[model samples]
Target: MSRVINTLDVALVAAAVIAATSLLSNDYYLRIIFMMCVYYLCAVGMNVLVGYAGQKSLGQAGLFAAGAYAVALLTTKTEISPWWALVLAAVIAGLCGVLIALPSLRVKGPYLAMVTLAFGIVVEKLVGEWTEVFGGAQGIYGIRPISWNEQPLTTQQWVWFAVVLCAVAHVLIRNLLHGRFGRALLSLQADEIASSSVGVRVYRAKVIAFVVAAVTCGIAGALVAQQNQYINSDFITFHLSIFILLLVLFGGAGSMYGPLVGAIVLTAIDAALARWPSAQHFLYGFLLLFALYAMPGGVTGALQTCFKRKPKKQRLSTGETPKTTRIGPVASGDLLVVEGVTKAYGGVKPAQNVSFCLQRGHIHALIGPNGAGKSTMINMLTGVVAPTSGSIKFLGQEIADKPAHEICRMGMGRTFQNLRLFADLSVLDNVMLGHHTRMRNGFVSSLLGLPGALKQEAITQARALELLELVGLSHLCEHPAGSLSYGLQRRVELARALATEPQLLLLDEPAAGLNPQETAELGQLLLRIGQCGVSILMVEHHMDLVMSVSDHVIVLDYGTKIAEGKPVEVQANPRVIEAYLGVDDEPDASEIHATA
Candidate 1:
């Protein structure tokens, strides 16, 4: 139903634009409309990078020039059709995006912005200096415009063409951003570590976002070059890149309609300020600062907030039975094996020669005092921290050196000791992101909104809801995960981990901040998960909860395992008791057990 409304809204806007264009005969107004369409194309893609993926890019002009220059050179130097040159230009720009994105892998925030800014400066200088290929300041002329029925389109026709392109771009982007891919980008922006733990390939996702932004900006530039039948270094400027970014920021960076709103309003402002050429830059700078400080969400976000309706209450229901199939590669022996695992930080050893075996379908607990390396073991197992020396295997696959996302894909799921929820996302969206690796839809299918992709999205949402029910958070599914109570956020994180459907679940201090009642409930939840054939390795400090729920207990002291046995047996070990209670002349075993 919401999808239908969104489609209708877009259709109405498109129809309105076409009607307005038909009535306007002035060339100036028509050109303004055309430029709006071009800028909108740029902003729509930019939003994916800056807003959703949280990548800071200030070099969009370089990508735009890539397309503009590609079209210019291809049409003048070769026998390529204007239409074919347009497509090739977009491809060239996407390649440029890949180049700029390489810097993002090593830097972030202001450093990334500087790298992109340098890229724009370099492109600007190259076009100005390279007269042989780019034609330099004199510019290239006689570029052929796109035509219908073998004749070049008229001025009004160009306006119509750009308007149609804008509509198409909006719809395609909306489709692409409404599913798992969208959620993955949002998750990537929220927390890369948490995103990877849920099986999102962090670097790949970043590159995809950069490419998306570049392709659209490239298309915009190609359209401009073709329509004007000219191109030059003057067309590519640092100011243009800033203007493109301003469109996303002032219109609402994350909102679907943000680009359209931004393009229309800012383009009009640009035209009005044309009379005061010197003041245009000043006003634009002011607007950027204002948007960053006073209107971070932009005009669309502010409008939505004003008219936002209360979310309907959701009722809890008995969750459907979870799938019974074991969620990992078939293996005949123990589910996991760790031998001689050691992790050292300079002179400090957080983990040393740790060896353990987790049998199929049992709950094992790792308990230790502060600095005893319980959490470090969890990190090593999940591939977040590489072991200095070790062998770690899960379901017969060596995973000690794998990337975090790859380890997650191999049927290992975990919760962080510190809550890592995608705070701005709803509880349901958070869980649905965990299914990203399992979904079969490809990028093209998602972008085009194919039936299979839509079907998978629906199925994933239903399954996510079921997980919320299982965690007693069904009624709060629509609430932001960050807005929930501390205990509720923990549950949301658990449900998200469960969405990965792991055969081996590694939980790091799952009950860290929960009250006694919540801790007890978490114990029951762990037991229930174990009954479903999922083996558990939990790092916990709550002795009572650990003793009650864990099938085997391992005690660590000063980064080394000191005891391993049944909970009762570990409780009776003098080393375990001394570690917990400290060395004393007469330490009571029962007192140590109670204190632990």
Candidate 2:
């Protein structure tokens, strides 16, 4: 029932509902609905980037001003149509978004906030100082109201126009939020490094989000300029930017209705408080603080949390799951070849001349002490680092220099040494985040909730559930990954990597800190994952686990592959024993067995 109600359809229905209410009401109510429509459009754009894309913007108001001025100046000074001005304003604002994001990409956290805040101030100052085109502090006035030929728009026409713009913008953004691009943005919020490792161009995704958001704001600005019949720089002040940011946060950061809900609720409150202007802002401040402290997820998010449902993990296959359509020994020869892959620091050896082969459908273990460069080897294999001198080929393709996400899209996936879940999001969303690269829906269709995106989501959710079940984590699907136990988090991480559906899965320290029982379960899980034909390169410190499962073991000693062979043969090698100080006095084979 809920899934059937979507952006365009829902927005149309909502507009109809608002229209019905206004049809039977007085002029006052119509005006209120018009204002609500405008506010909702602005909030929708704010939510797209700051909410869905995981950016914290402080310059949307500046973009809004740019659009308003574009329309004002174009109409007052030239014969340009308002429609063309709106288009030009959108382009100009989008260009500003690109410029702001290019520089903001390198700076994050408070620095990111500061940069954007400064941009808003700078844009404001420029609008005030550029006396040639802009009217400085006086602002451009006498703007012509838009209308059909021979007459300006009536109150009813303006209200309807407001309804249409709001409805259209909402539908557009909603569709975009559910597409591949949306997932990419979510992946950034979830774990940027992991997202990049999965083939998401983080910078590109971010910039696109910024531009989309800016353009949406520009559209809203055009509508506002036409409605008010006057424009001023003060209208797009710093406070307005912060208000929109807080509005997105207050509504719900990752939901279709969050922005609309936030805008409506706040506007209603402001209207009610208009009689007490002195205390109104103070009250808003209090509410903002209260919401942050008591309802951080906002009304929609909190309600969802209260009644959240965990998606069940699919049951494990009985007997055996089907392997990749090959009857050969797991990971048949030379599909993944890393030869003489060497990476070292200024003076310390990190990974010295490492060489190995991973055939498809095999489980390959890379085991070593803390400083043995196991992580480095995994990094190099996944293209997280460029080898000082060496090569890595996946399916006979040189993937050594490609970024991590490209390797993922090329059928390589990985999990980190530490858990990197979106601490704020649920387990289901975490796996969903991992499916960004695999999803086919683009932003436009997703935002529109076209039949294509709906079908695609149904497929994605079903696949995500299957992946969850494969890793035995379906039970906690709705719980935040951060709230799960260490063992469960490890499995969820594995589930996330599975979401990418990679041919080669690289796992770093998969069994670290697990209890004996959990470790046994992990061993079984790894064997099972390998049986599904995912060639695995894993780093583990547990010799017992490695010796039991690894068909081929690469032993690293202080960042160099000193030994590589079947676990049995490598275990018995004299140099391998001495590397671990087993040769103070040489330990016999029997003694080594006894220690094990």
Candidate 3:
């Protein structure tokens, strides 16, 4: 029934667009709409890298020019069909993207921006100076109209042509933005090392993002050239790239409708504001300043913020109803097995020949002196850093080489020593990102709001809120995660990790910087989580909390284990005492007696 409704909805949209195309006949309005479509196409390309992939490229104009020139030369100077020229243009531009993206892999920030800027200048100059091939600064002219069935298209026909192609591009981008590709891009955007550690294919994701952006630019260029029937070096200027970037940014970089929104806003403004010869710079600058202050999230982001909602609390039944109903099978036996693990950076060793195992429902403590390699051991086990040597078996499988995402999928999740929440997003948004990892919806299915995606999103929202409530962070759900107090941020990070429903959770310094009361609360929270069958490996300096909560303790100093047993056994060991005091220092023989 739902699928049938969706099919009907799509048919209605197709019919509406066909009808609207027939009605929009004014040349000025048609041109505005066409330019909006073109800009939308360009912004979508930019979004693949800028928004989704977290790459900053100021060189899109170079790719756009390469594409335009490819088509211009093919149609005007050669015998290739315009359709074939479009295809070749996309390929050429996409290859150019591959070339630029290679160097980009090694550089970021100002360095990357300069690299792309230089590339754009080179492309523009070559097109102008290479007269034999490009017809010099004047550019090749007399390109034929886009023809299908050998019929030259009219202006009205071309407007509709632009509309159809841009619509197709939008649909494709929407799908790509929500699927495996989208997740890969977003993951890399957040943390490259973490993404790679999680099996995201970082290098491949970067190249693919660049290629997709280039292809979209090529298509937009072809449409623009065909619509104008005249081309020049000026058509693909460096300013054009900057303009497209600003447009996407102003429309909400994360949204599919962002490009369309940006295109309409800017095209209308530019066309209207162009008539004031001397006031152009001042007017445009003022507009940008206003946008920066008033709508920094861009149109879609602002809208999302305004419309954001909390998961509604269920009205309790008349009798015995509870909030949580654990539906999945609980983990059994040992949840995580660590055997003979060692890690070294350069000549510095962190963990040496350490072994431990965590049961399904216990808090395992990893404690040590400042340099004991406690954090280093966690890094190795979680795949943040490769171990010098060792094996990690989780949930009955050898998971030593698994990526972080795969580790997460295999029921092992982790929190960093330093909180790494998506700071710019709301607390709820941050949790939603974690929920994204658990979802099974494809990109295509998500955009169509497939029955599965809708149901899954609702469940994810409910679960996320429930986890937030457990962490005592439910009230701050609408606030930006970064804006929260330090204690609150840590809990939010924990809530995010919990959203993945891990069987084994590795927490590094979770109690760091918390007040005594907060620490006590956290201790209780850990106990409650343990009762729910999630195993824990905690690295903490909060001795009171550690001694009170952990079922088993592992002590280390100078990158080597000094003792392993129950908390009391580890606390009483003389080797642990000596490791803490160093070789020459006598254990205060009096306090040592009490410790014993």
Identify the leading candidate in terms of lDDT: 1
Least accurate 10 contiguous residues by lDDT in model 2 = 321-330
Tens digit per residue, CA lDDT, model 2, 214-257:
87777677777877878766676777786777677788877778
Total clashes in model 1, counting residue pairs 3 or more apart in sequence or in different chains:
0
Candidate 3: tens digits of C-alpha lDDT, residues 1-596: 54455445545664566578778768887787788878888898898888888888888888888778888888887898888888888899989999989987788777877888888888888877888887777877787767878888866677777777776677667656654467668767777754543335677888888888888887788778777777777776766777777777888777777777888898888788778834655655565565568887688889998998754554432432223424224756777788888887778888888888887777899988788899888887777777778888877788778666677776767788877776766788667666655778765576565677667767877887888777667777878787889998998888777777777788999988899899998998888777666788999888788889999999878788888889887776778777665555555533432332
lDDT of 1 by residue, 179-209 (tens): 9889999998899999999999999999999
- Number of backbone-clashing residue pairs for each candidate, in the order shown: 0, 12, 3
lDDT of each: 0.89, 0.77, 0.76
Candidate 2 root-mean-square deviation in Å: 3.4
- Could you estimate the TM-score for every candidate? 0.97, 0.89, 0.79
Candidate 2 yields a Cα-based lDDT of 0.77
* Candidate 3, poorest ten consecutive residues by summed lDDT: 319-328
